[model samples]
Target: MAKVEKVKKKIADIFDLPHDTVLGLPRVTLIGSHQLYIENHTGINLYEKNQIRVGVHKGEIQIDGEDLQLRTVYSDDIFIEGKIFNIFLKEQV
Candidate 1:
């Protein structure tokens, strides 16, 4: 891990803060099987009717679905609605 990551981990552990929240990692939430919320995201990598990829601090988040729509976007959060079929985390390698 990089020195900054190590420091962030230590700080997160000591303060009982969620690593994702403290270290600017991505936090993904699913609502039923049709919606998603992502926080602390960097930007959208890809957008399509069937898939969406979002960049984050150390990796990316991908959502597979049908009829995907970017419902809302904000500085720190994104909402997507569709027939969400799968979600996965991809690390930088």
Candidate 2:
């Protein structure tokens, strides 16, 4: 991490803050393979019935499942509903 980021992370750790909230990292929530919520996403890269790709700060999120559908999308968050099977994070090169 950069110096500023390291300092910010140290501060966050010292203060017991959530890393995702303090470091602008993505937060993904899955519920019983039927619902998904992603926070701090940059945008949706791909959307299909079986897969979805979401852009984040330093990487992308890939979701694989059946009957995938986006329930809601906002500037920084997304909600999905379907039978989720797998989720992956791919770092940018």
Candidate 3:
């Protein structure tokens, strides 16, 4: 944690955000105990060995795992759950 604290000031000014704000806020979003979807996500960071798995298509997504989960949905949402071994996105007809 000391490593993070050391650069706290430089990080604040570089980002032009409040100093404590960065430390104060939680970066994770759209989270549930077993599922989560982070908005504005460009890349994924895996913490555990098999926490989640996802695949992207033209406009659809599929996730899988033993205890896969999702936090919430957009106005356009679809939910499928099972012992998901595969997910294939379908184009709108």
TM-score winner between 1 and 3, please give it. Answer: 1
Task: Tell me each candidate's TM-score.
Answer: 0.94, 0.93, 0.24
lDDT of 3: 0.39
lDDT of 2 by residue, 1-93 (tens): 689889989999999999889899999999999999999999989999999999997999999999999999998899999999999999988
For candidate 1, the 10 contiguous residues with the lowest summed lDDT are 20-29
Q: For each candidate, what is the lDDT?
A: 0.93, 0.94, 0.39
Model 3 stretches astray by more than 4 angstroms:
1-11, 14-26, 30-32, 43-65, 69-93
Each candidate's number of clashing pairs is 0, 0, 0
Measured with C-alpha atoms, the lDDT of residue 87 in candidate 2 is: 96
Instruction: Sum up the clashes in candidate 2.
Output: 0
Which ranges in model 2 have alpha carbons more than 4 Å from their true place? none
Where model 1 places Cα greater than 4 Å from the true spot, the runs are none
Residue pairs with backbone overlap in model 3: none
* Stronger candidate by lDDT (2 vs 3): 2
